[model samples]
Target: MQDPTATARPRKIIHIDMDAFYASVEQRDDPALRGRPVVVAWRGERSVVCAASYEARRFGVRSAMPAVRAERLCPQAVFVPPDFVRYKAVSRQVREIFLRHTELVEPLSLDEAYLDVTAPRSDLPTATAIAEAIRAQIRGETALTASAGVAPNKFLAKIASDWRKPDGLFVLRPHRVEAFLTPLPVERIPGVGKVMLSKLHAVGIRSVGELRQWPREELERLFGSFGGSLYRRARGIDERPVEPDQPVQSISSEDTFARDLPLHALDEAIARLAGKTWQATRRTERIGRTVVLKLKTAQFRTLTRSLTPDRPPASEEELRAIALALRDRVDLPADTLYRLVGVGVSGFRDREEAMTQPPLFE
Candidate 1:
């Protein structure tokens, strides 16, 4: 048997990301908001920032931060509520531009995507050139900006896309991959969160260079499956392909309350969230079998309970009932106060696949 990777050709992948997508669209449509700070979010105590323009970022505003905090960071920032209908229209335009170059386009979200242009349909001489063309087209057609990263694989491409912000392109040539990654902090790796960082620090591993010194066996012993991943990433060895049209794995709706509520007070919120999630799920053709209930305590600790029914939820009322029932499985103290609640549906299958499954008692 032959080794597949050994004979495989180097891939040319490009990651494209719209710069401050939601905020930029707001600025683009309204000329008066162009030069100033723009924060896209609802103005509410519980609202969170959806996107912040470069101007707002300079004031320390960031996406997902509470809206109230964002206001404190940039008092003069213009806040605009998100208009997903408009954003989706612009996203479709960007997707059309990607299809002009390659068929292997994987959209990560409304504002970012990965394109495998190893064998592009366009006559661009290099992957870098393709990225440039795409960026130019986005700017020309949408009156907005995008950043691009050209690399041999998805991981590097994603990292490189963010290397230069707003409107820039970075190409990571194969020859320079090692030198580029060597000095990077371990936290730069996608999965290295705060917990992982503390673990790496305790072991005196700070940079990719430091992490590279550890043997895979030791790393794996310390970190389990993730340790194996850290080992590969430290050496710039990512071979994952850009899979196009990845199916929607889940849909959810969540809310944060202005005041923390005891467990018993979550019933109304859970039902409301379940209704929102059910409506969102209706837009998809697949059916979901699992109902998930999530809660965040006042201390910010998160917990989730999920149930997969014998049959997928057949109506909004069924979804709401299952979501409410999942709350019963939460083992937190009765007095525990929760600041957030979420309802979600997952375990999706095509309508035919779901219908074909034998009934629990046929």
Candidate 2:
């Protein structure tokens, strides 16, 4: 084996994505479900698609779509309630397989993770080999298949992972980054959601090559803070390392209404989101002092208001009250209709720092 540190070599990152994770699990456990369209969800107006087999996807049924719509799309689809306990167990077994290759495992969700195996404990000759080995191990141990992408950075690896999915492997060599990324649509870049996509389109920048033509300062002026990220990603430049444990920034919840509602109609929605945020925050030792309210108007503009209280909220009611009062911060017309509302807790401080702070009255 040659020395890894003896010369300059780009970081080797791999993104592993389990194919139709929950659906695959269901099919694995039930022999009858194999090669059949399956939709895992409850039967109700509020029930959403938890997962759909590739067979169901052919009928335009997908995860997160309404269960009613999923049924209409594929009437013959087998519906099953989700079994998260089994899914998590399988996820744990897959994670154990990752720990054998490298400690730099960053789990994005139960179904996906990023591994930095630039230096592998297994002394693998290259990242591609490690990806293959892990995929083989997962299929043998878990009775499932995963797609693997090997690249020099996380962004490229994530894209490459999806290039040939459902038991596929793709590699983006360091020398081929520019050639591979330049011709792709701007939407292929991370953070280019619908709103950002519209913004890019309005600017007459449809491809990454066109997006990269703009000066950084101009891009920043046009898109605010996200513009910097846009500029770098256009050229396949991502400096972020695959951190094992990403820090928690906030806990929040929001709901999109079936019909746009006036601001006065949001009281119940605010309370629901606040209660969820408060419950989620309880899982963290870090204390949050700021209460944030997020709203989106029917005109498609997003507005945010936040208040850092003298003390963190002590109960769900207090959090709800703070979130509800934030509606007054909206300076729009009284008749302004809103489509979404959210409540959150942020500005985190560890218990040690929170305990030592002087009282607000002081």
Candidate 1 lDDT over residue span 1-362, tens digit each: 11212326989989999999999999999999998999999999889999999999999999999999999989999999999999999999999999999999999999999999999999989999899999999999999999999988788888999999869999998878888888999999998999999999999999998998899999999999999999888877777888998777899999999899999999999999999999999899898778889999999899999988778889999999988888888998899999999999987889888766543311
Q: Which stretches of model 2 miss by more than 4 angstroms?
A: 1-9, 253-273, 294-304, 327-342, 354-362
Q: Write the per-residue lDDT of candidate 2 for residues 30-136, one digit (tens) a residue.
A: 99999999999987665789999999999999989989999999999999999999999999999999999999999999999999998888988989999999999
Q: What is the C-alpha local distance difference test score of each model?
A: 0.90, 0.89
The 10-residue segment with the lowest total lDDT in model 1: 1-10
**Candidate 1 Cα misplacement greater than 4 A, ranges:** 1-7, 352-362
TM-score against native, each model: 0.93, 0.84
**Candidate 1 structure, TM-score to reference:** 0.93
**What shift in Å separates residue 292 of candidate 2 from its native position after superposition?**
2.9
Best by TM-score: 1
